[model samples]
Target: MPPPNERDPLLEISGLRTHFSTREGTVKAVDGASLTVPRATTVCVVGESGCGKSVTARSVLGLIDHPGKIVAGEIRWHRTDREPLDLAALSPTGPELRSIRGREIAMVFQEPMASLSPMYTVGDQLMEAIRLHKEVTKDEARSMALDLLRRVGIPRPEQRFGAYSFQLSGGMCQRIMIAIALACDPALLIADEPTTALDVTTQARIIDLLRDIQAETGMSMLFITHDLGVVAEIADEVVVMYLGTVVERGGVDEIFHDAKHPYTKALLGSIPRMGAGTRQRLTTIRGNVPHPSDRPSGCPFHPRCGDAVPGLCDVEEPPEVVFGPARSARCVLHAMERSVR
Candidate 1:
């Protein structure tokens, strides 16, 4: 694939909605969420658990299943030489989609143990992934897999290659997952909390590995995580989600230093800072994320938002306010606050 340029977005998710049809009610996992993943840049989607970060990533890969569907929206996958493919319009399980999935796009899931098969050796799975997207002989695939394992910093890759997922530590398994995801040299990588279950050191290593890989490959990434520290470390852009919707999006620095959405501010405040008073309780966003089936109307976060205008935020949905060329927020208060400024 040609190296991603700044001319156009690599992936554009517009008004996307992924919902599950449960017996009780429809669970709006992703509610009209839209964001752009620019070429060769890292866009981190972050929120509390169940805010639809994973669902959005899964929807991009057409992995949403059973009673859950991409109810609305367009996932436009831009091509350098051809027309953009509307992933949302394609058959979720069709051959065309399958061809694009592993070859053009790849994903490293949250749980490495669960994502990897216990039945297959790490080498077996890795080689299979390589061979699936490339016309390679068994020896060639094996060589590529070994090379990837080494690239991902799996020590003694040859030794670990024959081991099963269950036989490896969580960090090792996650490294294996990254190796598998990179085997095909996909243009885009969707990493949904790839470091979630690892130790702090392992998490830092994983983050560094991903950054190095991105630098070498120039592949665009959509990283889903709840860790603001991770977001600050890796993101070129940040998309803050709450209750299945994107509340704010901007440059990493802009989001961190000048967050406009109440939800985003609350989330930033909740991140544990170095030298914060040992005895002082960490700031907490006052209420739990509403269940998908029970999402509040208007501003999904208004119930806990300190700056919420009762009559406005509680009664009417806010329109997205464009703060500048690259900054925007879906919050009524942003417009009012900006007008005052």
Candidate 2:
């Protein structure tokens, strides 16, 4: 592992804003979001639905579509043995971005059923992915695809390779998706809720598979999810996002035990405790996440934050205050407390 001070981040996102130009109004999906994924480490982006977690990932991969555009900020990616490339400045459809997408950076989407094409057989899709980025013959590509299927723990690798995505079970399809994503051995993997629709047992297996692969390959991962349990299990560092902005960021232990922001605290509190009595109800946040077009002013979470101050939190956006080394929060209370000390 690289030393903290000397380690160059594999990906650094700064002040990223992705908005959609809708017929009703412009939706500010991701407003000034920033975070970093250090080399060979897992950085999990956690938030409730509609908090722009997926948008942030899509923006990083230049996958935002029509009506939605990444209007500002820098996504600087540093690949090994190459110059730093600003992903935000690259064309979404150009050859440069296409080459980088699957070859250098890969994404495992939320639903394999939706992401996989029923028109093509699994072998065709996997072999195409391998051949696109690698200089290999057709026979070699097929061999690599089968090897990947086996690596991801798919049963009957040869039989499954001939089947289309629709013919496979959800867990099987998800495994194939993982196999395809890992086919090229990319430096960075963006897993956007990869375990969302799977059963608990399958989810555990998939998470374990990813961990084993990361350990063996030494690739960095940017994991985006709403599950705190998943964050606790897999994350080296955590970024807490709300309303398209990061509210708190720190080590997993700090975010879970010493959360300084009300939003982060509430989120952690909402997780169900294991040994608590059956009579105890699980905690929940007060209200639903605000719509992007109808977002409140100042701190986007003030209306929902339990400890929000009257004058300050609703009127002014709080500057990010450093609480410790590599730990920070965007909240008026923390900022004021830090100033007094």
> In lDDT terms, which candidate is top?
2
Worst 10 contiguous positions by lDDT, candidate 1? 1-10
Residues 1-341, candidate 1, lDDT per residue (tens digit)?
A: 66546746999999999999999989999999999999999999999999999999999989998999998999999987888999999889899899998789999999999999999999999999998888999999989999999999999988998999999999999999999999889889999999989999999999999999999998999999999999999999999998889999999999999988888888888766778777656668887999999988888998998888978998889889998866899988776676799
CA displacement after TM-score superposition, residue 24 of candidate 1 (Å) = 0.3
Query: Positional deviation of 34 in candidate 1, in angstroms?
Result: 0.1
Q: Mark the regions of model 2 whose C-alpha exceeds 4 Å error after superposition.
A: 1-6
- Residue 186 lDDT (model 2): 92
- Predicted candidate 2 versus true structure: per-residue lDDT over 73-141, tens digit per residue: 999998666678999999999899999999889999999999999999999999999999999999999
Q: What is the TM-score of each candidate against the true structure?
A: 0.96, 0.97
- Per-residue error (Å), model 1, residue 310: 1.7
Q: Local error of candidate 2 at 313, Å?
A: 0.5
Regions of candidate 1 where Cα sits further than 4 Å from its true position:
1-4, 279-281, 337-341
